[model samples]
Target: MGTLVTGYVVLTAYLVEPDGPWDQQAVTNSKVAGAIGLVFSALMALLTMAFVRAGWLRKWWHAIPAALAITALLRLTLLAAEL
Candidate 1:
């Protein structure tokens, strides 16, 4: 779950062009990246829930990843608005 979240962060950092001019292609790329990030966040949430259910992780530990996923989704939403 951590790996998925980290990979999503890195992928967005690479794919999102916050400083660059928003060309048509760049907007398209950003949209695609946002969609992918949403999927990644969902997957992370599911995996975290699974871990808690399977007793591999404590209930309190679920908050960490849930917070990260929420933040990631918020960031992606803001980026999409910008594009």
Candidate 2:
């Protein structure tokens, strides 16, 4: 769930301005959105970790969502830098 949400947020940031209207302001807006998405992804990952520690998520594979969220956040960071 967290991975899906992070993917959607990152995709939205990527698709913000697909055309030639990518001015400085547009880039700044996209960066801001990406930053927010990164923060959200981080929080979701942390929450997933907490759940796992609390025994709510018993399986070892339950950590995969947090790992995927972190990966998405890393990619989003690179994308924001490129923007």
Model 2 ranges off by over 4 Å: 1-4, 58-77, 80-83
Best by lDDT: 2
Q: List the candidates' TM-scores in order.
A: 0.62, 0.60
Per-model C-alpha lDDT, please?
0.62, 0.63
The model with the greatest TM-score is 1
- Across 1-83, the per-residue lDDT of candidate 2 in tens digits comes to 76677667766666665335446666666666576667767777677778879888766745655555564465456555342
Residue-level lDDT tens digits of model 1 in 4-75: 655566366446664555566765666666566556666666887898899998888666556655655665
lDDT value, residue 20 of candidate 1: 54
Poorest 10 consecutive residues of model 1 by lDDT? 74-83
Q: At residue 52, what lDDT does model 2 achieve?
A: 74
Ten-residue region with minimum lDDT total, candidate 2: 74-83
Model 1: per-residue Cα lDDT at residue 70? 61
Error (Å) of candidate 1 at residue 64 is 4.1
